[model samples]
Target: MNIVVDAFWDDEAKVWVASARDGIGIATEAGTMEQLQQKLSIIVPDLLAEDYQGPFEIELIARSHQTVAAA
Candidate 1:
């Protein structure tokens, strides 16, 4: 199965939040991108094991925003 995870940096929360779509049930948040990725590594397998069988792959898509002033 192909799992797609989308991550976004929440400035107010000061953490990276991620969610899975397209039939993948996943939602989590972490202080950093690395932490978030690590969480997915463990959480994904457990989630998939419930309904899916055999090997699975994950595709992560992340988005972040920042404002820059003209120099």
Candidate 2:
């Protein structure tokens, strides 16, 4: 199965937040992108289905913003 996950950097929390947008009931956050990926690796499969042991694909979308001075 294929799963689409949306991720973004929380400015207030200073962390990367990830969630399954396809109604997989998955929401998680981590301090860094690597950490978030690790969390997703485990969380995605478990939430997909019970005893779900197979190859799966995960699509991650990241959105973030920054402030800079324009000269």
lDDT of 2: 0.85
Who wins the lDDT comparison? 1
Deviation of model 1 at 47, angstroms: 1.4
Q: What is the C-alpha lDDT of each candidate?
A: 0.88, 0.85
Please list the residue runs of candidate 1 whose C-alpha ends up more than 4 Å from where it truly belongs after superposition.
none
Candidate 2, residues 7-69, lDDT tens digits: the string is 999999999988887687989999998898888888888876684665778888889989999
- Model 2, backbone clash pairs (residues 3+ apart or across chains), number: 0
Give TM per candidate.
0.87, 0.88
Best by TM-score: 2
Error of 1 at 62 (Å): 0.5
